[model samples]
Target chain A: MTGLLAYFVFFATIATIYAIIVMGLNIQWGFTGLFNAGVVGFYAIGAYACAILTGPARDTLIGGFGMPFLVGLAGAALAAALAGLVVALITLRLSEEYLAIATFGIGLTVQLVALNAAGLTGGANGLYGLPRPFWSLFDSVQAFNLFYLVFVVVIGLLVWALLARLVRSPWGRLLRAIREDDVAARSLGKNPVSVRVQSFVIGSAIMGTAGALYTGYVGFISPIDFIPILTFQIWAMLIVGGSGSLLGGVIGSFVIWLIWTGSGTLLSRLAPPDLQAQSSAVQVVLIGLIIVLTILIRPRGLIGEKSAVSSKK
Target chain B: MIQAIADGLSTGAIIALGAMGVTLVMGILRFTNFAHAEYLTWGAYMALAVLSVTGLDAGQTGPFRFGLGLVLATVIAVVLTVALALAIDYLVFRRLRGRVNHITLVFASFGVALIVRYSIHLIFGGAAHYYSNDLQIAWLIGDGLRVMPDQALVFALALLVSVVLFLFLKYSALGLAMRGVAENPALAAINGVHFRKILFWTWAIGGGLAAVSGVFYGMTVQIRPDMGFQLLLPIFAAAILGGIGNVVGALFGGFIVALIEAIALLWIPAGYKIAVPFVVLLLVLWLCPRGLFKGSSGGSK
Candidate 1:
């Protein structure tokens, strides 16, 4: 029972973190018509930034700033937003494919910087033993699980409410318009580039916050942690849960995480001991299959975009 | 240095091979096929299988052990890659045709890339393997600057392939139809050019070239799933930097990216090797998206 609870807690922690990341991506791609394939870059920055600020000395490469957790999260968000702004300003003006190229390039540069600037990021070993909220008061594993769950749920609700408002407002309509017809929006005196950069910044900030929560929960941040695979996974979630939907974003995370955990557990039991070492990779491949099959069948996703009610409850 | 020049040329040759696939798909189909790297990875794995299948691992010698084995591997990789590309077109891309927007297609390609890469991992464990360098005996020159027989063979194949491709594209009827479709699909269709047929062929040719590049790349470095994936950024960088639709431009861009990647290793930390291609791509994209060559009208906005 305790093992099951811990596994649930662990998977829930990652799913909540991924929900925020996917929501951020939804804002950029689903709303603003920007294709940012380098979402992991911003996520990593947020994670490493907060990790460095709150980390201890000696073991810390760029850690030991000793800043409070929330403050570090804010700084991380701001940094990611700024990076998004810079990249958007440079490449958002380009067409569809060119934009993809630029964003992908930015992702590589971020990975390189994180890997090379070992003094700041602890290099490949990754930052470990991160301080979690209320970690001190909780002596048992179950207690810590409940504690982090509250923190994650609260943050998730706040993000959900805020994004819901943004999607419903006039800015949201403007975003839809831009996505539908860029030239037409430009003709109406709306600066598509400026709006895109704005959306990119805000979305990237959300991604950073997700990263902050990820670091605090997992208690580690490394260059390897924020690979392109994460970007692909987030995208898969967004697609599976119905892009441009608030409830979908949250629900998608839980569904994908459940499948990942359940399938992994089942496969480990079936496969030989030697092959079990590669189960994580097998899980990754399954995720890819899910994305492809899901996209091919239902491009809008499971929940999909809500339609008007006729005689519904 | 002559050594750097040789290294750059060989590196350029491989990139040129990879970039051809990227350029063809872009010119003909209109979205960057991000899964292009999977072809290279598949080739390397196929080569491994060939070596194991031929049972030449113990004490086999002679030109056939090295030469024929490599050739058979390339052929197998090419066949597999072409069929796979054709399948992707038939399955995902064809359905997406005339239905979705451009950004939708781009995201779809990403989905395909994710699927293909993970499938590779699933089929072949994510471990790195290498072909023995015993056959890679150096030929001539003062220092370790001499070309190995295998390296010379790869360069020769690249040169031959490009020449033949150019001739085909310039002289053949089907090639002309493909070029026409790229120029203006509506007009080409009015002229009775079969649009879908051209796209299928483009995927095949592109996949074959990608496999060739993969074999050469694996011969130089160890074969790992991420090897082809890591090269993707540079491959696209070469495509866009060379001018998206221009074959010759891709060749030059390939060499430029390879030279920069190799030379950057001299100064930067080894971990930053992946960043070199993007840096060059960014420079080219920022300064001259048109690049050094005159691009086909289809590539330009």
Candidate 2:
């Protein structure tokens, strides 16, 4: 029973971290119609930022500020936002496809750097011994897991409330207006580019925060953690939840994560031991099928956008 | 330096073939098909399956590493790949057409790519497979440069395929119709061109070319599920650098990108080679957004 509880806490913590990332995507893609495909890039930047600032000093890497967790979180958000700003400035004025390609490249580049730049990022092995917030305050593993879960939940809820409020604000409506018809929005004397830049930055910052939270929970960071698959997974979550809907995005995160973990377990149990390594590919295939099916059958997602501002063809 | 150039030329030819398909699809389909790269992987694997079934992959044909069986497999693979491409279009993309925006289509293509690539992974395992393990000595081609017979043949075949495609698009009735549709679909529809027929031929030609490229790549390199994805960015860079819809430009762009990557090995670590196309792509986008050969003949513009 205690094991089950611990597992639940662990699962919920990861799901909630993903929820935060989905929320960030919701703002950029769902609300603002900005297809920032490099979610993992920003997530990595945030994770590395937090890890470097709060981690103990090491000989092999550049960082080891030993700052407080909250300060590390702030640094992560700032660094990710800055990276987002640079990408946005370069690609936002171009076509959506250009943005998509550039962002994808950026994500790949980040991973490559984390793999090769040993002095800065500890190379492929990645950084370890990351300080979990208030980890020392707990005794047992279960107690720490429970504590971290609550801490993440509180942060997740805070982000959710803040985003919910922002979506209802006037700026959110402008984002939708631009999304539906940027020309019309432009004619209305609003700077669509600047608005998009703002949205992209904010979304990136949120993704970074999620990365920090992930680092905190996992207590480790590596290039392996920020693969293109994570970006696709987050996109899947947003698409399954309903892009423009905040609540839908969060719900989609949990639902998809559940499906992801459940599929892995089921595949392990069903597949022969010899083929266990290849079963992960099957899970990827399932995700792909889900994305295709959802786009075909439920373009608006499970909990679709509010009808008033729902995208009209 | 000479060896790198030789390798670059062969690799460039392969990329050009892939890029041509990408450009054609983008011209007619009006969205970047991310699954297009997977067509390369599928083509290679399909040929592999056929070769394995025939037990022909084990034997060598003359100076070349491949055999008569590979020739037969190539033809079959082209047909199979075309069918696969059309099937996917009918099943996934055809329904989404006109129902959603181009970005949605792009997203769907991503999903399709994942499915296709991973399906290969699930079936073939992650380990790399070779068509033939036969080793041939590289020919000394003056000034300490060496050229493999396989590379020479692959490059020659790639050029032949490209020239054939160019001529087809220039003179063939179907080719003209495809160009017409790509230029102005509504206008072409009004002018007696069947939209569906053009769309069908686009996939057929694109998939056929992709199959040839994939086979060439597998012959020279190794066949793996991730081969298509590893080459995805380079192919896209080629297509975009040549101008999105321009075939000739894509061909040239492929060579340029490949040569740069080959030469960049002198300055940058080989581990960072994957980033060369990305850097080139960003520069192209920044310097000339419409590509170097926009409004060229044989494309939409």
- Taken in order, the candidates have interface RMSDs of 1.8, 2.0
lDDT per residue as tens, model 1, B155-264: 77777877777677778998888888878889999999988789878888899999889988887767887888888988888888878777777887888888888777
TM-score for each model = 0.93, 0.96
Leading candidate by TM-score: 2
Candidate 2 lDDT over residue span B37-110, tens digit each: 99999999999999788777545767777778888898899999999999999999999988876678888888
- Residue B187 lDDT (model 2): 88
Error of 2 at B270 (Å): 1.4
Q: Write one digit per residue (lDDT tens) for candidate 1, span A68-131.
A: 7898788778888887887777677777677777777777778888888888777778777777
Model 2, position A22, has a per-residue lDDT of 93
Note the DockQ of each predicted structure.
Answer: 0.59, 0.62
Candidate 1 lDDT score relative to the true structure: 0.79
For model 2, which pairs clash? Answer: none
* Stretches of candidate 1 exceeding 4 Å from the true structure: A1-7, A134-141, A307-313, B54-66, B131-135, B142-144
